[model samples]
Target: MPLNIVLLDDEQHVIDLLSAYCESIDAADIVGRFSNPIQALNFINNHPVDLLISDINMPQVSGIELAQSLTRDVKVIFITAHSDYAVAAFELDVIDYIVKPVLLPRFLKAISKAQNAISASEPSTKELGNRELSNREQSARYIFVKDGGVKKRLVFDEILFLHAQGDYTEIRLKDKKLLLLGTLSSFQQLLPEGEFVRIHRSYIVNKSNVDSVDKDHLNIDGQDITIGKTYRQNIDEIF
Candidate 1:
């Protein structure tokens, strides 16, 4: 299911940019975009939202205050130019605190963090105590992939990297590899942003599996992957 998202920013351009970014991610659905904090608050109260992307400094009501007024279950990601609010943003337990001007890659990373947080909060079948289910049960940690005639479930944490094939994507795990009929861009939208990064045009590496990184390349579990020039700036910010 795509996550319902709400974007709030006083600046029209910021709102437009964020809305466009959200639209690019297949997992996110921007249900509301508002320049006024009060209108955003009202919309959120009336609609169901899985994530909230908001600017820190606004007119009448601040983003921090707006977040405080929300229910505990709502996840928030703060985007702002000032660094002084970092401590306060974290105090509210926001999913991420991004300093502007926000780059596409960095924004993607923050969105991924929010997705993971929301996934973690969802109740699993096991948690609900349903014992009649089959042994092959699906959970937030795994995704179902069809390989040839068989359907396989791949765990998110077990994945090491994903490389783009002609029109398909090859997912590399610690023990095996799976090929799916999809593009790198599609995978980019589906996968959590915080855990995976597009080091190259054809490759997305799991940040947790990354062992080390240098100027031009990054090592992931003994395998070396070249970092693309265009992504260097974002990669630098990450490491």
Candidate 2:
């Protein structure tokens, strides 16, 4: 039987691209494509799907949260522009994590892994080979951010904090800073929740890099940043 698959991403273009890719695969069937994670989750709950291709960052619900909420045994493949969510994806035992600006060849490789996983889970009529099909890798400890058309790899340990700068975000490192064209909320969803903390509406600090903390502000690398009043509760818990 062909694998029943569903696609979910906030971008309609992404949904279209992934849908076309699923159609190209001989053993896959495109069951649905949704821009809303909640709608996709509801569909998955009411239907039988073998795989879910999802984007990590969404408005109402994140793909990671959606995968965590599922009670069924559906394999997931995360497609996103950010690699910060790699740790969380691996924790969820997703079939693959494909970075965005997704090339067709790379996407095909991910689909192949999903196919192997689905096949392995079924009762085989003949003896299967001993070839290992697992795709889990060492959790990613860094991410590549595109700056001025160049991809700059930044290790997680080197990052001090992320500050929202209008339409872009400033990534503060140990020595310098880089601007990325995305929102703070997007990065918040990308980074591992345990390592990064949202101290304010405009700032997300690397908890390990924090030097000190007070009621109104926290010091990271000796630079004090204001803590939002609404986020004071989280700061209280951390301190």
Candidate 3:
């Protein structure tokens, strides 16, 4: 089925452009289009919205705020002229965030991503309690995080651990480190349950990547990370 999509932007022209792009590929059916985010939100509450394409820096309501207001299973793709809100979009688990003058190829790619995400989330005959299918699902897990101007796509298994650096979170892999502009709690939300545990206020380690665990710290990728008193329970439960 084609996705039920809503396009929202303060600029009528932007909404028209997005509508045209979606129309070109027949990627989605434009169920709604509104210059006011409030109207869009209200419409979404009463309708089936499979995908939401919105401009982030609107005057009525920021796209980030609009995405946060919804409490349903709708996929979101954010459009903005600025890259300032990418980290916030990341925390919200948005499918894709495009900066400014949305191109046809990029927009179609985002729609495709949303379609795949929706399809993957739905139960199928092959995924019904199939252990091998579960392992296949694990292989497809990944997220896009910005490292400076470049967006790095890291598979879940490649991540060794995560560390809090005040306002930024450090993503540690076996070979490199990337500091994303968000808190550890934000990154923690992106990880799968039971696979990653918060060992300290500043540290979260992947259980699969840990070399050893003692009373005070855990060794991961040859680096020692101290476990906090409060989070010892997390370690115990996971271990």
Candidate 4:
């Protein structure tokens, strides 16, 4: 299922950058982008979004306030420039708290948590919406892939990352890349949470495969991928 998303922030640059990054993630679609909180609230009244990505500091209303007012099962990921508000963000039971200059990789970390959380149970306002990895159990250990008209079965752990093209996802393994037709999200949902994270909108890197991360990028087996500003916190928490 595609996650319908709404993004609200006062900054146009932040909104545009994040909107593009969200589109790249291929996990969901940004149905609306509102610079005005009141307008955003009004839009919400008429439309139900599966996810919300909002800025904590706003003139008329705070992200926390909007979160409290939300009546739907939608999970929220708060984007803030200040680190001081991280505790407060979490206190509101936000799925994830991200510091400003959001990176796409970090954003996916939040999305993963939210997806896992919503998948576990029916979402409600009062329940903590954050995705937790402690309760996860291993399911499939291997995946069967078709390459050159031949079926190939490989262990899930053998995958290093999956890179997305226009209409296909290149599954990167330890030794080779397999071309498969589908959205990156389809493979993302199939992968185990603890082992993998979408480091870029187009790339899902294995946490174990990651060698290191710099200020603007992540290093995985000598490959560097830019991280979006909004996703930094969750990335820091995990990696």
> Which residue runs does candidate 1 get wrong by more than 4 Å?
124-239
lDDT of 1 by residue, 97-144 (tens): 999999999999998898888787766433233222211232365656
lDDT of each: 0.80, 0.80, 0.79, 0.75
- Per-candidate TM vs. native? 0.52, 0.51, 0.51, 0.51
Error of 2 at 65 (Å): 0.1
TM-score of candidate 2 against the unseen true structure: 0.51
Q: How would you encode candidate 4's per-residue C-alpha lDDT over 1-239 as one tens digit per residue?
A: 66767889999999888878887876676667788888777656434467889998999999888888876566889999988888878887889999988888998898888878777876554233222211222355775654655778867777877898854789888888789754576556556667888767778888888888877799877778888777777688886
Error of 3 at 35 (Å): 0.6
Worst 10 residues of 4 by lDDT: 128-137
Model 1 global lDDT (CA atoms, 0 to 1): 0.80
Looking at candidate 2, the ten consecutive residues that score lowest on lDDT are 129-138
lDDT of 2 by residue, 1-239 (tens): 67778888999899888878877988877666788898789757545567899999999999999999886678999999999999999999999999999899999999889888887786432112101111111156765656876888877788899998854789999999999865565455456548889988789999999999988999998899999999999989977
Q: 50 in model 3: Cα distance from truth in Å?
A: 0.2
RMSD (Cα, Å) for all candidates, in order, is: 14.1, 16.1, 15.4, 14.3
When summed lDDT is taken over every stretch of 10 residues in candidate 3, the lowest stretch is: 124-133
Off by over 4 Å in 3: 123-239
